[model samples]
Target: MRLGSLIETKVGLNTRELKKMSNVTYYLKKFADNDLLLGYRPNSSKVSCNDEFVTAGDIVINSTTNEATIVSPLNEGKILTQSSIKIIIRDTQQLDLWYLCYLFNGSQFIKKQIYSLVEGTVLRRITQSNIQDLDIPVISLEEQKRIGESYRIFMVRKRLRIHREEEEQKAIFNFLEKKITYVKKGNKDEY
Candidate 1:
């Protein structure tokens, strides 16, 4: 099935418009590391040429992530700017959200199709039409649900592992800091 038939695409707000808003409103900016991790930053005072915006259940493909990632916007006004395309599934029943995300992020065939649309030498970009025009396999509702559920579980485990690693790193750093401080204090008399 044609991807366009299964999903709707929207262009997000540009950086220029986002910068005009109150800095308190967090916005997703492209080419930033935080943005790749589904993180948002305060709108910058500088103007931007890129335009993008995202709401709940929006799948964004951009240079930052270099792949598709689902986004759950915290507020209605949160905007995505720069090299991002927001994709919304037309019908959850027809195409499972998690399944679609998995396809974009994991399926080699689908990834090849998506990357085939890339254009430009220095800064490759995928056009919205290219995304819409791609073909998607039509799976049974039951199968889609099963795949979607599995994908969700995988994502949960992945996040948990990352959190655990970060905690371990912090603990190791704190331990080393305390030991260094104790040794420094002990040698103070020698100095």
Candidate 2:
């Protein structure tokens, strides 16, 4: 089924609108490294409605990455910039949001389409219609739930592993620094 038939999408504020200042909502912009929104900003206009805000379970896509990411809990009230588009699922019963995100971030079929669209563009940006019109594989609700749950677990584990690796590298560098200091100041200079 085409994703457009299953979900409604909201484009974020344009660059001139979303700015860093008095906080209305944190801004989700491009170059966001992880699954979380990174910065804060406010819209010059009045607080119109809830539709402008994004909550957890919403998916955000970037033209640069051409990938979809699930909004983290930390960014429940965040707004978005033009660099990102928020995808809202119309029916939770019919589809699993997390599973859909997994497919967008990793599925070859979706990636192929996205890559094709962004292939020769200078900004590599894709229109909302492109994402809306993507063809997605259909599966039973039960299957989707299972896949979504596993995908969530995989993300958690991947985060932990990366954190562990970073800590290990820091420790190694710290120890090396200590050894270098000792060699420089101690009995013999080790070159």
Candidate 3:
């Protein structure tokens, strides 16, 4: 089956519309880059009204990487950026959303297809038609759920590992800074 048959992809706000609004006060989290948006910053600014917002289970495809990941609750209420596209599974019963995400994100065959479909020279964009034409393998609902669950679990662990690595980097930097301060002051109280 074609992937497009099971999914609907929505392009995000144009660059101009997005530019007019301030990031300080956004109703949506502004889904763009996973690396920067994984953990949104806290602010006291009032949220502006918005009708279009992304929810958990929605898929976000990274324009650069051509990879997709299911949105976690942490990223809900995000307005899609121009560079990003939000994918919604048409019917949940037949095709597992997470399983499709795994295939789009991890499967070498699909990745190659996506790579070939890329059109733009600078941006390397994927059109809706291209997305629709990709092939999908049909499997039983139960088996699909199993694979989807495994993929979801794998993604969670990968995120946690990334978070741990970032924390470790911060800790090491702080330790070195403290050591430098202690050495410079000739104070061993904390050291």
Task: Give model 3's TM-score versus the native structure.
Answer: 0.75
Candidate 3's C-alpha runs over 4 A off are 17-51, 186-191
Off by over 4 Å in 2: 19-21, 24-26, 29-32, 36-49, 189-191
For 25-54, candidate 3 gives per-residue lDDT tens digits of: 222323333523342222221222332565
Q: Give the C-alpha lDDT of model 2.
A: 0.69
What lDDT is obtained when candidate 1 is compared to the true structure? Answer: 0.63
The lDDT per prediction is 0.63, 0.69, 0.67
Higher-lDDT candidate among 1 and 3?
Answer: 3
Write candidate 1's Cα lDDT for 1-191 as tens digits: 89999877765556686678675444444322233343322232122232354544456666434467655445434566655677766666687666776777778878788777777777777777878887888889789868866876777666667889999999999998877887787754431
Most accurate candidate by lDDT: 2
Give the top-scoring candidate (TM-score): 2
**Pairs that collide, model 3:** none
Q: Which consecutive 10 residues in model 1 have the weakest lDDT in total?
A: 39-48
Count backbone overlaps in model 2: 0
Worst 10 residues of 3 by lDDT: 39-48
Question: Residue 109 in model 3: shift from native, Å?
Answer: 1.0
Model 1 earns a TM-score of: 0.76
